[model samples]
Target: METKKYPIIVEQFHFDMVDPKTDTNQNVQVAMRQVEPSDPARKDELKSGNMFEIMVPFDVIPPQAGFRVSGKITRVVQTLDYFGQANEISPDDLEKLSRPLIEYIETLTYQVTAVALDKGYQLEFEASGNQKDNQ
Candidate 1:
């Protein structure tokens, strides 16, 4: 595998269980967006080919399965040779850039479910689609 052009740093992570009773299974929904950095220094750094940030919010609903998970994760990505605009990043590149945060989501969910349900659930995401499967 080729090394990624961007380096990712997670700035924030928050996870919570909306429904603790995991009874029924529901699909996971993951969404991502690029937002202007609220910090002035970071905004300036973007212009200088330094970094940009993205917000990834996810929801896992296993209705009646004793648990529903929801959270938002923020990551700051360091750029190399690219700094024109956040939207300018291609969809594929953005997906690749956000891979680590997605894994974070998977790991956290597994850990939480293991302790709460007495069994661990594994979440896997494919590159081409939003489909997720729990094992």
Candidate 2:
């Protein structure tokens, strides 16, 4: 049997900061959820296996730093061939698909901190095998 294949493309992306700057030493938390598109056309596209959406919400707290960041990143990914349900995608695959958005988060945080503080702070995220499903 031939393996089904799907090419994923990001259709839309948006990022927003909740608390742009903060002075607190707290741990970082990251979570991801599959969101339903608000647009009827987008919903149809998703139902037809043409696309799906994933939102990653994160919070970063620096230790004794002048600046902290908390934001959410949402990306709409298009699947070119595979016409399967969103829940059918594996966790590993989901992590791989969300990698770019995660990197964006890191990049933006670094850039923002560079100006907010005297130096830039680097952040690294690892797949903790924890996936949250929000309906």
List the global CA lDDT of all models.
Answer: 0.61, 0.55
Q: What's the TM for model 2?
A: 0.60
- Residue by residue across 11-81, what tens digits does model 2's lDDT show? 33332333535544333333334445677775765544445666666655554444545666666666655
Model 1 agreement with the true structure over 1-135: per-residue lDDT tens digits: 122234444444444455646554444333444445577775665554545566666666654455666667666666665645666777787777777877887788788788877777777766675556565
What residue runs in model 1 are displaced by over 4 Å at the alpha carbon? 1-50
In model 2, where do residues sit more than 4 Å from their true spots? 1-48, 129-135
lDDT of 2: 0.55
Each candidate structure's TM-score, on Cα atoms with residue i matched to residue i, is: 0.66, 0.60
Evaluate model 1: give its lDDT.
Answer: 0.61
Query: How big is the RMSD of model 2?
Result: 8.1
Q: Which ten residues in a row have the lowest lDDT in candidate 2?
A: 1-10
Error of 2 at 127 (Å): 1.5
